[model samples]
Target: MLEIKNLHVELEEEDKKILKGVDLTVEPGKVHAIMGPNGSGKSTLSYVLSGRAGYEVTQGSAVMDGVDLLELEPEERAAAGLFLAFQYPVEIPGVGNMTFLRTAVNAQRKARGQDEMSAAEFLKVIRERAKSLKIDAEMLKRPVNVGFSGGEKKRNEILQMAMLEPRMCILDETDSGLDVDAMKLVADGVNALRDDGRGFLVITHYQRLLDHIKPDVVHIMADGRIVKSGGPELALEVEHNGYSDILSEVA
Candidate 1:
């Protein structure tokens, strides 16, 4: 459902290119895992796709479901069914989590010309989704990510994803600070959202996340470009041998 062609990106302030030429296609119902070392532009790809600021797209195009994502504003992209789960979810101190979620959900709904959910309807739906993600009412009542633990923050991100139900999900380092159990919980939540009409671009440094998510395609990215692509075995290869072997062969 996502297609990118010869994408090149650079920092707006520094003029330093980060993504040289990235070409990737994520089909609906497929999970694509991108594994790479530091500075390989894995996160850059996610940011560019999500229409984040500071990164200028000098060349190429990114489209979702035939919609040109690069041409839309950030909120328009969200309305177009693009979601990015950040590595570090920021805290919104004054806004309660439920309030924030409800606002976001209704905003997107309004953007898409859909009727807004009633407060009662929203509460019922969020409660059901939170229960599956193990998010209690107490957590929902607190300010968003204000005092949450690492695992709690990550779970909260998943909760947002579950509630939004975006068609294309880009998870950038969702496993960064998570423990083994926490990672499993996040992965399970992700897997539960997997569907035939949705796609996932999982950007991670390690293969452990893939063990639970089980990508349909695995890509090795180095020096801003995807150097190799394979199946789940590619992740195991990276796990066992590291990026050195693949980087050397590609070089």
Candidate 2:
């Protein structure tokens, strides 16, 4: 349900090009994994799509189900069904997790012209979703990500995804700091939300996460663009051989 065509992006301050003509299409009901080296612009693509600041789209377009995503503000994009789980979730020191979630949920609902969830209804749903992510009540009462371990932060991100139920999910290195068990829990949470109406763009550095999520398409990105597209085996190939072989072949 997401389509990008010849997308080019550059850093606003430095004017250095990051994404050079990236063309990709993510169909509904499929998970697409993007595996790339450190500077391959995978995160840049996610940031631009999410409408983050300090980047300029020099050319091309990104649209979700025919709606131009590049035209919307970040919150507008989120309201339009875009959810990004960050590589490093930031700490909000004074904002309680449940309070933050409720505010965000209601804000999106209001943007979409929907009724706000009652406090009791919201409590029930967030609790249920948090339970699935192994988040305890004490954790929910804490300020968002404040003093949370890496695994807990990541799990909280998944919890947010579950509650939002966005159509297009962009997980930028969600596996970055997770342990084996924590990774499995996060993956299970993602898989539970998989459906015919949803699509996932998983950006990761390694294949270990893919072993759990099992993407429908795997993309190898290099030098700011996608170099190869294949099935799940492509991730395994990267795991065994590294990016050297593919980079050379594509070069």
Candidate 3:
């Protein structure tokens, strides 16, 4: 459902290029894992796809189901069925968690011409999903990610994903800084959202998270390009051998 073609992203203030002609495609009902070392431009791919500010699309395009994603604003992209769970979720200290969530949900609904849910109905669904993700009710009333543990922050991102129910979800290190239990919870949240019409692109540094999510395709990215592509077994291989073998090939 998502196609990234010859994508090159560069910082406008500098001559440095972060992504160099990267190409990837993710179809519905599938999960794609991008495993790469630091500075491989994996997060850049997510930000570029989500239309985040400060990243210029110097070359190529990302099209979601034939819609040109670069043409839309960040919120517009979210309204068009795209979600990015950040590697480091920002903690909006002044905004209540549920207040921010309701605003986000209602904004997307308004964009689609759908009727907004009442507070009662939205609370019911959020609570149910939060329970499934093992989030506490008290946690929902506080400021967004404020004073939350790493695990709780991750779960909160997953909760937002569940509420949004986007067609394609880009998880940018959702597994980062989590304990084993928290990682499993994050993975389960992602798996629960899987459907015949939904797809996921999970970016991580290791295969441990893949063990939980069970990706359909595993890609090894190096130097801003996909150096190798394989099935789940490739993830295991990387876990054992590291990126030395793959980076050599790409080099």
Candidate 4:
């Protein structure tokens, strides 16, 4: 459902390029894991696809079911069913998590020409969704990510993803800073959302995360390009051999 072709990106203020002709396709109902060392532009691909500022797409296209994402504004991209779960979710002081979520959900609904969800309906749905992510009501009452731990922040991101129910999900370094148990909980939360209508691009550094969230396709990115792609075995190979062999062969 999501296709990225020859995507070249660079910082808005500098000549340094982060992604160089990166090509990828995430089919519906498939989980694609991108494993790479630091500086490979995995996160940049996510940000660019989600329409974050400070970077310019110098070439190529990112299309979701024929919609060119590069031409749309960030909110417009969201309305088009693209979601990015940040590696480090930001904190917004004085804004309750519930309030922020309700606003965002309703805004997305309104943008799509759907009726806004009432407060009672919203509360009921959020509570049920939050419970699965192990989020307590007290945590929801607090300002967004203000005093949350790293795991809590990740869970909150997943909760937001669940509530939004995007068609294509991009998770950047979701396993970073997560303990084993926290990782499993987050993985379970992600797995529960799996279905025939959605696609997932999971960006992670190691294979442990893959153990919990099995990917149908695995890709190795190097020097801002996707160098290799295979089935789940590729992740196991990376876990055992690192990127040296694959990088050299592709080089």
Please give the lDDT score for candidate 2: 0.96
The residue pairs that clash in candidate 1, if any, are: none
Off by over 4 Å in 3: none
Candidate 2 off by > 4 Å: none
- lDDT string for model 3 (1-251, tens) is 99999999998778889999999999999999999999999998999999888888889989998899999999999999999999999999889999999999999999999999899999999999999998888899999999999999999999999999999999999888999999998999999999999999999999999999999999999889888899999999899989897787667
My TM-score estimates for the predictions, one after another, are 0.99, 0.99, 0.98, 0.99
- Name the regions of candidate 4 deviating beyond 4 angstroms: none
Residue 83 CA error for candidate 2 (Å)?
0.4
Q: What TM-score would you give candidate 2 relative to the actual structure? A: 0.99
Clashes within 3 Å, all models in order: 0, 0, 0, 0
Which is better, 2 or 3, measured by TM-score? 2
Give the CA lDDT, 0 to 100, for residue 245 in model 3. Answer: 78
Q: What's the true lDDT of residue 146 in model 2?
A: 97
Model 1, 25-111: lDDT tens digits are 999999999999999999999988988899999999998999999999998999899999998899999999999999999999999
TM-score of 1: 0.99
Q: For candidate 1, what is the lDDT?
A: 0.95
Model 1 lDDT at residue 182: 91
lDDT tens readout by residue for model 4, 100-199: 9999999999999999999999999999999999999999999999999999999999999999999999999999999999999999999999999999
